[model samples]
Target chain A: MLIRKPADIPPSEITPRSTYVERRRFLGKLASVGGVGGVSGMSGMSGVGALAMAAMSWRPGDAVAEVGAGSLGALVKSAHSTNETPNSLHDISHYNNFYEFGVDKAAPAAQAHTLVTRPWTVRVEGLVKKPRQIAIEDILKLAPLEERIYRLRCVEGWSMVIPWVGFPLERLIRWAEPLSDAKFVEFVSLHDPKQMPGQLFPVLRWPYVEGLRLDEAMHPLALLAVGLYGDILPKQNGAPLRIVVPWKYGFKSGKSIVALRFVAQQPVTSWMRAAPSEYGFYSNVNPDVDHPRWSQARERRIGEFGKRKTLPFNGYGEQVAGLYAGMDLRKQF
Target chain B: MWAGRVAKPSAAWLARIKVALFLACLLPTVLLALGVYQDRLGPNPIEVVTRGTGEWTLRLLLITLTVTPLCRSSGWKWLMRMRRMLGLFAFYYALLHLGSYLWLDQFFDWGAIGRDILKRPFITVGVAAFMLLVPLAATSNQAMVRRLGGRRWLRLHRSVYLIAILAVTHFWWLVKRDITEPVVYASILAVLLGMRLPLHRWGQARTQAAAKGRARVTGPAWPRNP
Candidate 1:
């Protein structure tokens, strides 16, 4: 199965923008003939953004460089970006699951869009050999985007399939060059309620921390994401930065992040600290292991709520199950 | 239960009960506020905590009300001062419960929410109890009772009996299966309702008739208090 690469971004097309209205009229005029804009630019097939991105030929070098991880990467070798602009699909991506703003799952999405991401600095600290503040842009420039379509399973019995554009956390951690004492890495989301109104309510601890065991952090499947759905990660989603750990529950994937600390011990996690019995630090999405108050055996797949069956390991169990060998997930969970 | 003050409240008795009631009412609010401030309320704790507090408030309100009738026949008027604060406490928790449902659960999805209010039987009864409490809550004060006329306000607040019954039904329907808690609440409600019956003479008449029938068979006691 061909997975989506991180940069399947519609290069120049503005499908949902106000400018899409004007472009639609122009595309209408073009399609009035024998469809001169070619198959990729056809509005009837791919989204106007995808088509427009396809239509406009970037500089030769830029084209090869940007589209290097093309066609949704390994997930879908042949699938093209559809014209169906379901904002709700994108909406859920932007909206659900961030607690830096509030404990309510959707509050961060509603409140976090106002965050100023530029001029933001991520402090790399703790057991790292070179503890330094790095700009988010500096981190993004390190590796060209790659595609990874991971199944995201939330603790609240919901799941989603997201095509994320990111470098592997392993890649970034290797560069961070932590000392031998580094046994874990913790991530902290920005905690200002002046921009994130939900933080003002004191739902969860302000910074919303998440951590990974050193081995887990260095695991190749762990992703350090900067964007999704072929665009800069929307402000509600996490804006400039976030983490995506497909094997674990979604909370382990911290959002609106600003700090990465390689630590010597198990780091503080947001939900686990909020209620230890209910949310464990090792929040692996296991169907057999039920949350203390709720069941994890079933899940609502957001858009396809009633229809979709929540598969074991969100359908990626074959890829990630080996990570949790002989260990009993229920106990760790 | 103070042996000395049981006969009469005296000067400081009402004041002491007032202090106790005020603290009981204020402490929960303080703890909940601190939990909110310190990020202590776990994810999705609003629903559980809200309902728990409301259940406690309603149970306490009934207990406080029962005190008056308990003391009247049992001569315990010292129970009076705590009733208002307890009733207000019920209203306070009810307000938080409603706010949680509105802001957190519903997210102002007004149309779907309105449909749920109409469609869901438990929600209907819950809303009915909530609506009934509003008038009782508004008329809680002596000033409001004076303004509305004490007798009229008393009649209006009598809706609380109906509210308690609806509350029991709401609790019963909310739990999918295990109803041990609701059954306990229902038993307490039954006792509170039963207490009002003896006050109305229906129960007294039944007891008197029973006593008279017994007297005809076994004769009266040799000595009486009178």
Candidate 2:
């Protein structure tokens, strides 16, 4: 009998969110019973089975108070499972690599509370017909918000499944109406040293900036996320607004985004500028193209004990691979 | 009197001290093992194990480097006996550190491990530091020392300084941005290396001068030929 591969299984036949989450808890219980033997216990299941069973069980009833006032969690659509379990809320929020906050994985969670995201304004400029600094509130009203669960693969060889609430980046880009010459979309993050203590040290030329080619930015998979896990975004997790490029490394999805500029040339990203050899501008999640410092072939999912092989374009190849069609990913990476 | 007592520790006392030091050196590994057995290494236990082992290796390397200078400064010659054990412990921790990387991180994937050692600068320096320690550890025994002779053995062990430098560099290069830990280690190693330069020469010169004074006390009355 021919077994159907997970990728080949139609969305209609996929497991329900409730069943998927229940199976995950069951597996998690089984794993704990195996008593911390690393990934061996979790490895009993196939990688794809584990990925689909990895969703966090946060529902509408769990800590509604933590959702924060005026949160967009209510507006979030029901689960459209990305076929990958998201990192636990604790793991997703705690284990971050936001250099603007500090270098340690825990620093962002500790230090990002000081960030004032309420009065945030996102400036849209450079090669756009209309240059404006839209108020955070006004930007929220610009387009209808939608929930999307996307896989975030970090360049440091770790990954997370994040349930993001936002609208397509193309909506905002279209609203700005880019000039004919605009070939790239540059994202600039808030650079307040007072709010972000890590800015006191020159980790990377601050006001951390990242960029994407215009087509990549306009892709349907690209999201301008305002919240995660059906709640207001935590400051550490890039509160107010941030980019979510599911196919690229986590660093490429700049946090605490304050500006979006359409440029004629490729913009210098913070990581790419700091270490040109280690981080390329494109920085797509390609396992075959190893990082100069570590192999990108495998990534430790945030909550899992074992590492799983990294997928091409972070398992979104069908949705996003067409953008990089004839290009040498190894060279570009 | 206390200084004199420190200078001339009895054989039994030294033996007891050696055993205590050995157990003290083993404490981190013991606690780490307990943590593993009890499942208390937090969410990322492999990382905890890897980093803990790596840190112990670096700490032991620094401890090994301190032996000679400490012996010179305090005039406690017996302290030199602890050097071999300290060096061996450093190698033990280094082996555990590499084992964690090879077994836990790389899962004995030779191709991936080889690529990491070759491509990553930090890993390269780390591998270099570990390789340099192998010879020092191999010749640490009395029989090997006798075979190699004192002069050759001393020369071989001096590479520990280089290993310390490389080990510190490996750590410094591994971090993404905040380097407070590696910086502290670098500062300590720098001072240790510096203390050995003129102070070490002064120590040798004083020993030679004392030897000359002893020769004068025991020399023949008639100083015939010059």
Candidate 3:
């Protein structure tokens, strides 16, 4: 009897950057030369023989770029960030939590690349001295981009440690120069129905909106990430530019942002509007404050099997706990 | 009496159908095992197992609901014999779904599980639905049905409709955005429940008419036509 254990193949290793595209082309030529029998023989007549044959027939159309590999900056070490092992680029690319592209966790990974990020402009308005439309390129030049490894905790009980490349959001806020009356900062995402299919349905109000206290926005820990893991941020991971508030839930960090408004009154966010009780405006990662669906006490880190105990403020309690001082997290959550 | 005269299904036929139903019910579990063994459950195996079992549980429940309407409309009275088996299969899948969540997903964290059931609306409804299934599954046999008379047995089983609603609601609220799948399931359940109303009366009338026709054809001859 031939006993064969299925080989554990890391997708990142199998399909790295441009290599996967080249391999697909090579496989296509090979398949043309010889069909199923050749595939079987090449795969050593293993249990995965059929898969090898299927792989040969697979085209390289919709070729996904492997992001988060640029060595533009030295790795960042922050007291707030944990030393936990980061999830692989492949897992980060494929296993997404972005709902703009689609509801399924994997949907954004597959669909978000179609989104246009280049030639993007953001309107900085509301309670500012100069309300200007700044190009994304100019936004990148607003401050020198640095590497910052942060742990992102999703409200859905999953977390990921990502090495992001961006400057402190405060720099941009400082540049915008909010007036004294500016109490809250509202962020609006791109609202193209044709590109983001999820927006077509009434699952959520379009132009996915999120907000933060003006003070929270100006916090040094708040980041407007342009890239991840030393490379240009993948479209799925919110390319061009996106907010990265490590202390809050992943949804709080709006993606492909198009507008920033400094408002007097607190803004109602997309999720907050959709289900007020379930998602609060201040979606701070509090393990004690469970979501209406699941416990936040523990979170499954991407690429890992076992779950780790969730930290208050996603392990940035020292930095962000002060922002919510004297406030009841249970009610806010 | 019409019951004895209707001709009970042969023991061998019953045995064969039971075996077939058993194997058919086992198919999903087998495929799930094969999938796990093959590492085909995508990135999150626990999630795949959890959702897969939950979906199967709902599907089997719907299938069990279909059996009554199917038998009534088609006049395949013998189909009634399979309803208990189908119901048990549904219970079995529900058990697997719960087990997958408890063991695989939660790692048997009883306190957390308890908290989730109390806190989460979806989990609360799902737990209620599964709990309601327990008594019905336990009393599925003839002895227990006889122990608690037909009316009480029927009243207990009628909770299946409530369970179906809770199960559907459980699925509906869990999803972040896409409601298409839950809506489809809810529609199927609605049709199934709808059949039990006016359709039930129509089916009963048709069934009685068919039985009377059979009675006339196969003779009782006692008070015939008098």
Query: Which candidate number maximizes TM-score?
Result: 2
Please give, for residues B1-226, the per-residue lDDT of candidate 2 as tens digits.
7777789888998999999999999888878765654445554567778899999999999988888778766868788888889889999999989988888788788998898888989999999999999998898898897898766777788888899999999999987656899999999999889887886576467658778885333322211000
- Kindly list the interface RMSD, in angstroms, of each predicted candidate in the order they appear: 19.6, 5.0, 11.0
Candidates ranked, most accurate by DockQ first: 2, 3, 1
TM-score of chain A of 1: 0.72
By TM-score: ranked, best first: 2, 3, 1
Window of ten residues with lowest summed lDDT in model 1 chain A: A33-42
Task: Give the clash count for model 3.
Answer: 1
lDDT scores in order? 0.64, 0.79, 0.76
Q: Which sections of candidate 3 miss by over 4 Å?
A: A1-80, B1-24, B76-82, B119-121, B141-156, B202-226
TM-score of the first chain alone, every candidate: 0.72, 0.84, 0.78
What level of docking quality does candidate 3 show? incorrect
Writing each residue's lDDT as its tens digit, candidate 2 over A1-333 gives: 122122433445545444554455455534533433342222354544433433332243433333335456455442333756555465578778888788877789999989999888888999999898888888888887886767888887777777788988998899888999999999999998999999999879998999999999988778988987667888899988999998899889989998898999988888888989888999999989987767789997765766899999888787678888899998988
Clashing pairs in 2: A54-A85
Candidate 1 structure quality by residue, lDDT tens digits, B1-226: 5876766777686788788778877776666654432324432234344565667666765665575566566655555556677777877777766665655455566885686687677778888888888988887787887798755776787787888888888888765334667899889888877777656575456558777885332322211000
